[model samples]
Target chain A: MLFGLLETGFVYFYWGNLLMILLGGGLIFLGIAKKMEPLLLIPIGFGIILVNLPLGGLMDYRYELTAQRSGVVQEIVIDETTRFAEGTAIVRTNAEILQSPVHGRLTSIEVQPGQNVGAGDVVAVIITTMQTDQSVIPTEPIGLLSRLFAYGIMWHILPPLIFLSLGALTNFAPMLANPRVMLLGAATQFGVYFAFFISLFFGFSFEEAASIGIIGGAEGPTTIFVTATLAPHIIGATAVACYSYMAMVPLILPPVINLLTTKKERQIYMKPKLRPVSKLEKILFPIVGAIIVILLVPSSAPLIGCFMVGNLFRECGVVDRLAETAQTSFVDILTIFITLTIGGTMAAENFITVSTLSILVIGVISFASAAAAGVLFAKFMNLFLKEKINPMIGAAGVSAVPMAARVVHVMGQKENKKNYLLMHAMGPNVAAAIGAAIAGGVFVGVLG
Target chain B: MSKEIATPMAGKVVSILVNEGDTIQEDDEILLLEAMKMETTVYATDGGKVKKINIKSGDRIEEDDIVMILE
Candidate 1:
């Protein structure tokens, strides 16, 4: 029986494939055991092994000998004419078309042979179905429900359940868009500057320091894009640090908030100003903000532009449809890709080091510092201001939007039942979004 | 119709501190509503004498139900 198997010529190649399998196994271990961004890294690591496996020419096109004539049958199976297994990642030799998940709307493509296309042009509108499944890379694309099976049972059920729970646990969205909440978020940003100096001690350049400092901001897209553009070499560590800290927000923020401000300060009663904002001011704010940001920091334009556009869409009375899309679907879709890419960039080799440990530490500290700075600034504002703004609401100045602000409101309401800080927090909350963007632009213009 | 202190959201009205025909100021707390784990005050948007209070402590209310009619 062994001799018969030896005659089939499978043993040598199978061993070779086994070694490749071992390589894949190593990647999985790195992603799973080491926790090096499992979502993207594990899939990519498995993909590497799966593509390399000599599965009797499954990945490629080939012909073989016929048993009747000499050996196995030789016929053209997969060829240039044959299309890719739908949804499988195939390198398009033709670089004319770009495939993008347009705001979660998946599109199908119809193509004829030998069509000329340019780089960065839309080839097809493929469905942007998110399947976090590693085992079924070669399988045809499935809808979200079916693909949920491709991933663990947890992946499908957890998201909606978690979102629902989160909606209930802490509805931070209102705070996210509010201005005072922004101040609180900004207060946490001193962490960025503090981290910047610390990274300098670790021998990072100014640009690298700025990239690392932003981890305190707890905004993933900003961190990833900044790191990718400024310090591509350290992108891996920076991203991992950013994400791990973001996940730890609940654990990280409270202790810092408590340590910075006393119970007496937290319990301070803030009389509601109840200032009703006119519709015209809301409309004018975004336009004026855009103009100011564009003039001051051209480099920051992209961040401010997208942000203001989203804000403008929300504020603009005429375009309810656009506003809804911007607030809900657009931001949500971008978030998935941004997180995946951020996770993907953190390779095991790049992430596991002393520098990464420092980045993570500093990142947490940066968030705390920003929160502190914001509260201090608010306290400072109280000295001269007649209204006697809540010092807690000042922390909302950071651009975490409604989350930081809502946290402030929650903390306030806990202290006194009548306090409603949500609306008051909105003023500084929106401002900080622009502030952070401008700061981002300044970093880019000076350093880039 | 007897004036009712209605619930804003579908939650227990844990406390109804006011009686019918009680003079209340605008922005004065009318009743205490517990919803989504937060105690919300149903304040009087307009100040008037509360007439014929229909809801007492622990009564439930729906959104936009007539809580009380000021006479």
Candidate 2:
């Protein structure tokens, strides 16, 4: 019993795990007590605590699992863990077949010889030391969560699926009522560019700056899509920052609106009843929007295409069943995994860097700048329009979805109790989300 | 002339602010609707007397559902 106790993970415990666990606890507190994005923060907080536990092995890469008694690292011929039959020779980068010391029956695999393999369904074992007489050494992947991350998130599958769910949930009626609010959404991208330059000034690589800057729009799936492609190493930081700040939009956006607009400007109101978008117009938007955006930025095809397809499912009116499922169960299930997997990436080793902290700072700056740009642009637009806009609604273009819209609505109500701005704000709310998606596509187009 | 006011979106009727036969002004709060976990105040579209109330507090409503008729 004493010997067995000694063999447990307690011996390897360190200060980092304790600190991260506390940090994770703080996130849980914010989600529950503060009611700040509980859906995302709760799972992510729990994931952090779970991943940081000693010897949990929840985040071990597949290559780290193989025990090498004696071997030299070799170049990777096939990075993917596709099917390999028993007794089939392993191919090297140089096209030289790996010679087995014995007739080894190596079947199940998800690996690269010398490099860390991402998520895979099979075990990747390369017979590194050919003549060492260590024949047929099999390996079991230790981390439970790591495999999920590698197979799901790392595969670039979940982000588009999430976008599909988002499209299904969206109501284009708001955006279509006022097509000009769409410009406010585009205006928010100024924050993306501003943050990119700031990150670059801080000595981050061009790609890293692009990925980090996307946090401004506070579109979680888009941030994940862009970061995963550009600066994958910083995904844990960017994702967490994106969500935490998104939850704080209600708090973050109000001050910025106050700074830029006068009391008279805040009290402005628009008509409650939109022009009432026809169902035919609703059904055509996804199709037309996809064509224009994808044509302009071909690299954004996956994100925008999936989003528009999902939107089509919602607006077509024929597939109510598919639309309902996509909106509810499909989206809820994906949110659990995507948020949890993101939290799983926040292990002490990956998250506690000085650079990660900087990403957090940059996130707030980008988000604020994005909201500011939207308000400023709306003010600029007022100069030419016969009818004035409530500049506060422009802040909804930060794309925190209904949260940003609600904040704008509430702020409007405070200024004038009779004002009904929610529907009007929704126009820019949805537009901001689209603008962020397009911004992500621009990055992927030029950089990816 | 009389007109019926329908909710433009789906939500739960949180509370009704007017009693039957009460006269109201345009943009007066008739009821509060909660949708997408946010509160939305449903305002009277035009000044009229509340002739019939079709929805009570905590009733789930759909788009274009007639909630009240005003004369």
Candidate 3:
């Protein structure tokens, strides 16, 4: 018995589990040492470690079982044999053979010898019995993280909250200063649809394709929100793909932007000053923007609504306290919980699959295509505009936020030292965020 | 009446674009405030000579707080 106990969890250890642990550790190292999305990656990495630990029971869940049937079997048949068969006589002989439908496993037989069992009686206690952990039987409760995860992510509360906090932190000046730049934002969404078609070609369902396509939006919250609602089974892989790609935007987008735009176009200087936005305009923007977007894509209302409301808190000039909370402490708390649960969801069984690999590849392609499309579209637009907007800013339209915009700024400076494109890039950068939200809403509305 | 230029929101004054006694035109930017990672330019409400300045670069101010007086 002691030997059996010693070998319990060890017998279940496999190469997959080891690899997952290493991947988790790698994420932790990346977060702490490399300082890549440390707020999210740290919790997520730790959660992954906790979940992958053998016999940790952090992921184990159990529930109560109630009896569904009361009467013992009156009929008996054994290989067409005409044995002593009818009434209580058969029941007496075959009572030991009875199986509880509620609990698939056999427990101590509830019915004692010559005892009558009634319906609704607790015939057998359904215990969580797993081969991985022979010691410490689980009680009748689901895992705490599992429950929080189900209620938080699966029920669709956390994503919008994250958006709300994001909105509180965002300043709409860039987008408002140059409204036409929104076209570049819309143009980048071509990556989403392009990847959608590609995923469909790979035999993914319309829902799955849509979920995968949103990765090109380059917004982690929107990607998670859409995937959790549509293709929930793949949330783990898709979210990782989204965030990993987002962090790699500086590396991924420049080549694509450079390849699409010539040195002349890259050197093109835009007027540095933006027309100052009025306080009234800033205050009205969130309210008006929300109404228009929600009306157009009701499915996107949750994320967009929260985002606009948070922006309202920032712009209204009356709710600085609320905006501060939303942007700082509240968001920090949500990020920890959300990332940890997201990481916990990626057990070896769920993450190490052909589908995960495919999603990762498609995610990168989606991001590349979005960046390329943005730059190409800008060049297309330059054909008509006299001012000749720099095409590099188009690459910022992929919603990787300031990172993509910064890449454009760096490229612009390299081409011409006098040129300052950070603010110019920001216009498309912020617009891309809205564009991605709209794309996500459309996908969910149509396919969800 | 001297026109008092006030900030529209709370933020750190990143720069004083104009100096006291400097001639300014209506809508000319007098100062820049950095808030929420975006810059807002505080413009002269009425074209006049700068009279008294209430805030300097790197000083924090609240909404409706007088930034400068123009005469």
Best TM-score among the predictions, by candidate number: 2
lDDT of residue A300 for candidate 3? 92
lDDT for predicted candidate 1 compared with the true structure: 0.53
Relative to the unseen true structure, what is the C-alpha lDDT of residue A305 in candidate 1, on a scale of 0 to 100? Answer: 60
Listing every candidate in turn, what is its Cα RMSD in Å to the true structure after a full C-alpha superposition? 14.1, 9.0, 10.4
What TM-score would chain A of each candidate receive against the reference chain A? 0.60, 0.83, 0.83
lDDT by residue for model 2 (A199-237), tens: 999999988899899999789999988887777668889
Q: Which rank order by TM-score, best down to worst?
A: 2, 3, 1
Docking level of model 1: incorrect
Off by over 4 Å in 1: A1-189, B1-71
Query: How large is the i-RMS for each model, in angstroms?
Result: 7.3, 3.4, 10.2
RMSD of candidate 2 to true structure, Å: 9.0
Angstrom error at residue A137, model 3: 24
| Runs off by more than 4 Å, candidate 3 | A1-9, A61-141, B1-71
Worst ten in a row by lDDT for model 2 chain A: A127-136
Clashes of each: 53, 8, 0
Each candidate structure's TM-score, on Cα atoms with residue i matched to residue i, is 0.56, 0.81, 0.75
lDDT value for candidate 3? 0.77
